[model samples]
Target: MTRDRQYSFRKVTLDDLPLLAAWQSAPHVRQWWESAEPYSAADLADPKAARWIVSTAGRPFAFMQDYTVHGWEDHHFAGLPKGSRGIDQYIGDPEMTGRGHGPAFISARMNALFEAGAPVIATDPHPENALAIAVYKKLGFEPAGPPEMTQWGLILPMLARR
Candidate 1:
């Protein structure tokens, strides 16, 4: 999808910890993310995940990450092909919520992965997250299957093939 606002991503670093913690704690974010605990250095150090701080014109506003689904411990994405990448993200700024930035940022990230030769990319949002599901569908993601309860939450699997 085309976006009037141009956005980019930067590799998430230690310097972003405070902002990450704050965003994770925001009521708007926590409502769905449900994480009250702060992100430890170890979380960002995860080898299977590539984390990024999404920005527009060099100003940070969101957090996003993509990880090899198969590399995750007992991931629900076993049905997906090997080399499949899964994404998770949140708009850190409350003011940015409801804007089209989510889809734009996701599109940019997915395009990067496709350019890098990834076979496919996927995302799992809570089944009840209609807003997220809608945005993902608008970006060409289709439901892979019904919702399943996992340690993270009840998720509706979706995939976008390159």
Candidate 2:
């Protein structure tokens, strides 16, 4: 699908719960996202956490999440600078996988963040998620350090783009 025809991103709202839950439950999407808990409407209700729905002509296609890293001590990025932010995303529709949407969507989001004064962003995917790792790398994210158990940290430098 052409870029204009295939995707759009909008701030997620409470009305998007059902669509988000369904996407989170898809087998292909769950493979890389298998965690014990499921997301709830309350989770997406937090104003401090930014979430977006990736859609095509108003239909949900994926989910993207971002949050400030201040005071975070999470395993994925325990060593990052205090002001850094975390970004995570998933393409919910199985058909959209392997079609290059990941890179485009992420790049779009990163550009927006940088424009909003974000200095750096980070993401950590399972080391075995080669497709995701490659897509992040192709968008100019570099391996931040040696792989840690389960999570591989990657960083994108915003100033480098200036």
Candidate 3:
């Protein structure tokens, strides 16, 4: 975590799907993600969601997405304060993991969201996903509730408030 990292998030486009698809199929990402399928037309067009290609020093290395917490019905984070948002991400390049990039990029995006007036930011990692939980905690997220079954599957809800 000592090395300085400069991260950037660029909006995802259709052309990036092949790269994202490859990442989604990686063993590390597949271990916890529900589906490895790249974005469908509907997903890409969803007005409430934002998908991004995460990069460091101009090299694309990860995928990320965020959305309005209450944008969907039955959403786990809907109970959060109005203007809250939710985030999910993965480092596509195997070499990028365990090197502090997760916290660095997530913090950058989270801070941007907060500065843009979001009241809270939420995340839900599978209960067994210790790596993700650790990263979230490192980024100031606290467990908001116990595990719950949502459309996304079982998750341990966590939150960080601005």
- Using all chains and alpha carbons, the TM-scores for the candidates as numbered come to 0.92, 0.79, 0.96
Instruction: List residue ranges in candidate 1 displaced over 4 A.
Output: 1-4
**What's the C-alpha lDDT at position 155 in model 2?**
35
In the range 23-78, model 3's lDDT, one tens digit per residue, is 99999999988788899878989978899999998899988899998998879888
TM-score for predicted model 1 compared with the true structure: 0.92
Residue 73 of model 3 has an lDDT of 84
- Per-residue C-alpha lDDT of model 2 across residues 1-162, encoded as one tens digit per residue: 255654677878777777777887889888777642545677667654688898766767788988776634454554555445678899988887887777877877887877887767777776778888878777777777665564333332221131
Q: Write the per-residue lDDT of candidate 1 for residues 1-162, one digit (tens) a residue.
A: 355778888888888888988999898898788776656689778888899999997779999999998885688985677788999999999988777788888998999988887788989999989999999999889998899888788899999998
lDDT of 3 at 4: 72
Q: Pick the candidate with the highest TM-score.
A: 3
Rank the candidate models, highest lDDT first. Answer: 3, 1, 2
Estimate the lDDT of model 3: 0.91
For model 3, what is the error of residue 26's alpha carbon versus the real structure, in angstroms, after optimal superposition? Answer: 0.4
Candidate lDDT values, in order = 0.87, 0.70, 0.91
Runs in model 3 deviating more than 4 A are 2-4
Candidate 2: residue 116 lDDT (0-100): 80
In candidate 2, stretches whose alpha carbon ends up further than 4 angstroms from where it belongs are 1-7, 36-38, 71-83, 149-162
